[model samples]
Target: MKKILFLILCFPWFGMAQGDGLSSTVDSLYREDQFYVGVTYNLLSNQPKSLSQNGFSLGFNLGFIRDMPINKRRNVSIGLGIGYATNSFNQNLLITKDGAGGYTYSILNDSQTFTKNKFSNQVVEVPLEFRWRTSTPTDYAFWRIYTGLRVGYVFHNTVKYSGNQGDIKLINVSDFNKFQYGLTLSVGYNTWNLHLNYNLNALFNDQANIDGIPIDMNTLKLGLMFFIL
Candidate 1:
């Protein structure tokens, strides 16, 4: 009779131990770091009326995201990442320095219209997001919505213009904004997400003028993001 009692107690304990181990394994697999790469179509906003966009400009981003769980269920997390991004603008306006040491924008004349006229900048960026997903350890595909802010510093700037008149390449343009901050969002399912960003700051400082109007252009981007775990 004692043996029968011992067997009953031991079986329950063994089952409980197996259940705990399975739970731990699921948690470990579910809560791993996520990495992402994205491509964007950049659009310049608040631009001068005379300055028209020629074609679709591009931006690229890559980063590793650390997810911090705040709830017991672990479906929601705070994501923080450090990333690098580069943005290009293709437009009809030319940026140049005026005699007073301020930057000036002029409408490109026919002679100045070249095969390629673009301004681009590279930045080191930090992103913070409140992330929510319907994800589980056994399921790798899920729906997600992540909204966040990004802060960046422009480390490099370049202007390239090629035409019949000549080819002009300028590095580290003085008028470009050095510090930039923006709002960002991503929403979708599985590995693909629709991403959007709108810069909160002007692309140039007060020292930049377009036809005596202070140039206050901002940047807007729409793109696709791919997440990899």
Candidate 2:
């Protein structure tokens, strides 16, 4: 996991350095009226009830500028995109019992007790965001900062657990569906954009308490992008 995160953070610097030369060529091409397409690698935001448990995610986007200029330097753009994201956690590590418990289990040479109702949920979603640029084609070598809002739907939300006597069960919360909505904020340079997103709805519609405590998850995401076109 550490290695995965290390690469996610470092990969951009590597690409940024290499893009310096390519930016010149890209600039010439876009001046004649063209489109841009790219893929973004997003780092899920770590927040309560967030869908970003997976730590790493990717998205694809494409858009066209209207040839109108902004600040006499940058151009305005609108685009459509779809993304897939998920959040997951290890149950055994978070669950616990008071030894006057229902079940006993061993994880990584450690013994722990847990109540029967042990479950965790991960959500997979897709969002569409509207993008606008704030930089010009000539001033900065190749950079633009953009921001927008996105709407997302949760396609899958489920929980997994092992009952007493080692009986495993996976529960599908039917109430949880591909129906979800959210907003996104991002800033990009030329072909790369950094993003942050938050889900506006609660994970559980029933308002049911989790472990005698309420669990309300608002998703968060951090991502990096690269133009593909």
Model 1, CA-based lDDT = 0.80
Writing each residue's lDDT as its tens digit, candidate 1 over 1-229 gives 3653354335435434533455334544256336777788899999877788888798888787888878776888999989998889998877665688655677797666589889999999999999999877755567899999999999999988787648877788888889999999999886667899899999988877865788899999999877766
| Cα TM-score per model | 0.84, 0.51
Best candidate according to lDDT: 1
Q: Please give the clash total of every predicted structure, in order.
A: 0, 9
* Candidate 1 ranges with C-alpha deviation above 4 Å: 1-25, 98-102
- TM for candidate 2 is 0.51
Q: 40-94 in candidate 2: lDDT tens per residue?
A: 4433232234212322234434344333332333355544545444444432323
Q: How much is the lDDT of residue 108 in candidate 1?
A: 90
lDDT for each of the candidates? 0.80, 0.43
Worst 10 residues of 2 by lDDT: 101-110
Q: Local error of candidate 2 at 134, Å? A: 5.0
Residue pair clashes in candidate 2: 37-228, 38-228, 42-223, 43-222, 49-217, 73-136, 74-135, 74-136, 154-178
